[model samples]
Target: MTYLGEIHSRLLDHRPIIQGETRYFVKEFEEKRGLREVRVLENLKNVIQETNEQILPKCTETMQDYLSQTLQRLQAASHLVYKLQQKEQEQRKLNNQHLLISEKQRITQWEDFMTEQHNKQAAVDEEHRKATERLKEQYAEMEKDLAKFSSF
Candidate 1:
């Protein structure tokens, strides 16, 4: 699936081969050095075992340190991701509030404009009624004046 996975699979598949090679090399070394001499063979075995024991603790410590560092880095990354998500949510809330405020302002402006238009219409109607009443009074006076002249 990935390069690391392939490498891990290959290592696992070759484990027996690696073990066989190690055994063969150790046997060859013993043969070349004349293992018939028991003391010499025993001494070499003891030396190899002791060296391996000494290095094992250091290797274990190094692996532990690497794992600890990796865990810390993962934790920090998780915290940062959480903070970013929180910030995004807050931003969305603020944007929604702004949109609501803008909508309310638009509605108020429309209402004010409607009220002003209604006031103007009412004023025009009142002026027309007053003009009509004045015209009626003038016509009545003119009729009375014609009647008097006709009688003379």
Candidate 2:
């Protein structure tokens, strides 16, 4: 869903270095509750670039090159992690929206069912009222006839 494929690959390239860095830092510093706070790889990306252009040309040290490569990897991993987090947030929001829509639809269906039942009851009541009125009329007629015939 994201256009961070290239970035993700770049991040993968530095995985080993970042892992080692994390392990080293976490092991080196034990006082902190979390290992991530001991950022042994601080600004490696910046250092790598500066060293490649200035220090690498002058010294040609393998350690410097290695450090640079590791930094580049870390930077990519960091970018990918940020993008993934955003994607997760977006997914959560979308799920919530879907839930809201479903709830509204359910409520509408219930309301429609209630209205239909109410209409049916009203129709039935009307029919019963008419039938009762007709019966009352018939009863009145019978009573009148009996009175005339019986002289009561």
Output the lDDT of residue 86, model 1.
100
RMSD of 2: 30.4
State the TM-score for model 2.
Answer: 0.43
**What tens-digit string does per-residue lDDT give for candidate 1 at 74-99?**
99999999999999999999999999
Q: Give the whole-model CA lDDT for all candidates, comma-separated.
A: 0.88, 0.87
Best by lDDT: 1
Candidate 1: what lDDT? Answer: 0.88
lDDT of 2 at 120: 94
Off by over 4 Å in 2: 1-60, 132-152
What residue pairs clash in candidate 1, if any at all?
Answer: none
Compared with the true structure, what per-residue lDDT tens digits does model 2 show for residues 37-147?
435455676788899899878786777888999999999999999999999999999999999999999999999999999999999999999999999999999999998
